[model samples]
Target: MCGGEQGCIETVKAALQGGVACIQLRAPGWKKRRLLELANALLALTRPAKVPFLLDDEVDVALACGADGVHVGQRDLPVQTVRDLMGPGALIGLSASNSAQIQQADVAAADYLGVGPVFATQTKTDAAPVLSPEGLATLKALTEKPIVAIGGINHANIGVVAATGVSAAAVVSAICGQPNPLASTQQLAAAWQAGVK
Candidate 1:
């Protein structure tokens, strides 16, 4: 659900089958109309499965597909503005790079926060510096918003991230570009569960 490039749909299907709680479509390379089409199709696929669908940086498409949420970066739509547009009940998430930003964020308007790149990642070439474990620990103490770790996350290191007490991990290339997406997704999901008592 991260990459709208080739193999994205299949990757999403595999993750859903492997028990991802939510999926956010975050590709910005596609045209608005095309993204809308993909959002609609993903909504159809996820609606019956009871999985929540989220959109990144595109409120119109999110609204068009009746998506469960929309993730807006700090530079993108303001959370308050998005809250106004989506109304109550629709989830709105914000991207945060550190504890200061997390604390400063009007989290009252957001349902969650995308906290990363926990490790350096190529998924977003312009991503800020990677947040070390200590940084994650700091952020964890700052807020109760379900902190969803993203960037450079995978089966190999997801458990460590989850152990920081974050609620979820948002994956991209790890599942999207894998030779065995379903197995990888299962492994990552299990890693997340391993963090629990």
Candidate 2:
């Protein structure tokens, strides 16, 4: 979720409508029950649209809500453990902020990799150092899974991120902090698509 912490649900709804292929609900500090309840609501919003819904850091909530997947940080939950818990066909996205983390990933068990804080970001203040294009390219060369770049991404700089040839870009404040979230999301999507050629 966006760091704004306010109107995040509406922002998520707007982004889904604006053509984001997936949405990951990331509330790191919330209670498990509260997260589950939110997941239930988000699942309803995503399922009918045929878009995948992902939970950040909690495999239990992902399974409990019957969500499409979950994104886990290196320390949050071991990827193998989450994969085992979720079983087959469950999307398990891993956060790989550096070449080392990417190298350490169990690629066979992961659906995709999140390669970022492309630039520094406020969303997760504790994010690793910004990954330069060369570093990202190095990691990309080592794996086949489509990479999703996140952190400090917005319409203005999305072109640079998309040029890395990864599958998608994960956004937070760009769409969530706007007065018209749908329009903002659409703008970013259009930008991303245009950059992808």
Candidate 3:
């Protein structure tokens, strides 16, 4: 789930109501105990809504919360390590910015790949180089694993990203920073639906 000044639990709830398929709680700077508290709170809402609750880059917090999954970056623990710690049933996502990284990842152990900076973004200060639409298409052509495009994803470019046949798109400010998250989520979701059709 996305976090915000308005609060992540509320942000996720509004997005879910607007038809978001999943939520990833991403508070990397938080302490483990605090992170666990937030993750559990997120799980409560996601569970009832039938939406998956994922933790960003913290396997321990994810396991402690019994989060449906965990999304890790390239520098984080390896996908196989996470899988071993998570066992075989939990969902595991790994980030890949380019073809080299994609070819190098332990894809067989991952359930999906978080592919992007589809556009330049300030959300993640250290985000990899922008993987323009063409880059995304190239990656898509090279893989059969599910891809969820992230970074600079908003209503403006969501359709283009979805057109690459990505299984999903992860957004932050587009929903969390908006004044009306529900409408924003609905618009993004609709754009994605239209793109896939």
Top-lDDT structure, candidate number: 3
Task: Note the residue pairs that clash in candidate 2.
Answer: none
Who is ahead in lDDT, 2 or 3?
3
Model 1, 84-108: lDDT tens digits are 9999999889999976779874777
Model 2's TM-score against the true structure: 0.93
| lDDT, candidate 3, at 116 | 89
- Candidate 1: TM-score? 0.94
Off by over 4 Å in 2: 1-6
TM-scores for candidates 1 onward, in order: 0.94, 0.93, 0.95
Q: Which portions of model 1 miss their true places by more than 4 Å?
A: 1-6
User: Best by TM-score, which number?
Assistant: 3
- Judged by whole-model lDDT over C-alpha atoms, candidate 1 comes out at 0.85
Estimate every model's Cα lDDT from 0 to 1. Answer: 0.85, 0.82, 0.87
List, in order, the clash count of every candidate structure: 0, 0, 3
Give one digit per residue, the lDDT tens place, for model 2 in 57-92: 988888888988888888788878888898887888
Clash number for candidate 2? 0
